[model samples]
Target: MLATTPKPPYYAVIFTSIRTSYDKEYIETAKKMEHLASLQEGYLGHESAREEVGITVSYWKDLESIKHWKSQSDHLLAQQKGRDKWYAAFKTRICLVERDYGFEREEQT
Candidate 1:
């Protein structure tokens, strides 16, 4: 499902990665990070997908929130694990969302 974000002028942290391999530890850590992120201040929402390459875009209210999330203790551990074992390579981009629009089909009963 797509993330339901607030009005524009927010921020998006786009994390794109190439995985070295998948493991139980990696899956668990990913889920933990997602949960931890949701509990943070200024966290709007996030959408993620993984195939040959993985992409996770998390929305934030401001850049400070993004910085806090990055320095979070557990998240710091996860980052090290990713570098040591999980990710072959990764790129993270932070963008200011100036404007946004989308459409979702209504479900019929």
Candidate 2:
């Protein structure tokens, strides 16, 4: 189960993707990136999953943090690889959440 983040004004960036049939070291790189992201300053919380495709949602304290993460050198390479190889298509959406709360079946969205 995914854990709830603290009360906010927070940035929620959602990444949803469909993977290509080609395979490489994606799982390894993904784990490494997750580790790196968790250690990043302003990283609040994250949730992710994979099946026929994948979805990852990462929370940040502010836009600056999100920008820093986006521009990180290693992550930039990964983004390029994603565009070139692993992902056939993807979509990202950023949302601002204020005073959020939730529970199963009846999430306080």
Estimated TM-score for each candidate? 0.97, 0.88
After superposing candidate 1 on the true structure, give the runs of residues whose Cα lies further than 4 Å from its correct spot. Answer: 22-24
Residue 73 Cα positional deviation in candidate 1, in Å, after optimal superposition? 0.3
- List, residue by residue over 1-109, the lDDT tens digit for candidate 1: 9999999999999999999965749888999999999999999999999999999999999999999999999999999999999998999999999999999999999
Which ranges of candidate 2 are over 4 A from the true structure?
Answer: 104-109
Q: In candidate 2, what residue range of length 10 has the lowest lDDT sum?
A: 100-109
lDDT of 2 by residue, 26-102 (tens): 88888988888888888988999999769999999899999999999888988898899999999989888787766
* Residue pairs of candidate 1 with colliding backbone atoms: none
> Best by lDDT, which number?
1
Candidate 2 matches the true fold with a TM-score of: 0.88
CA lDDT, every model vs. true structure: 0.96, 0.88
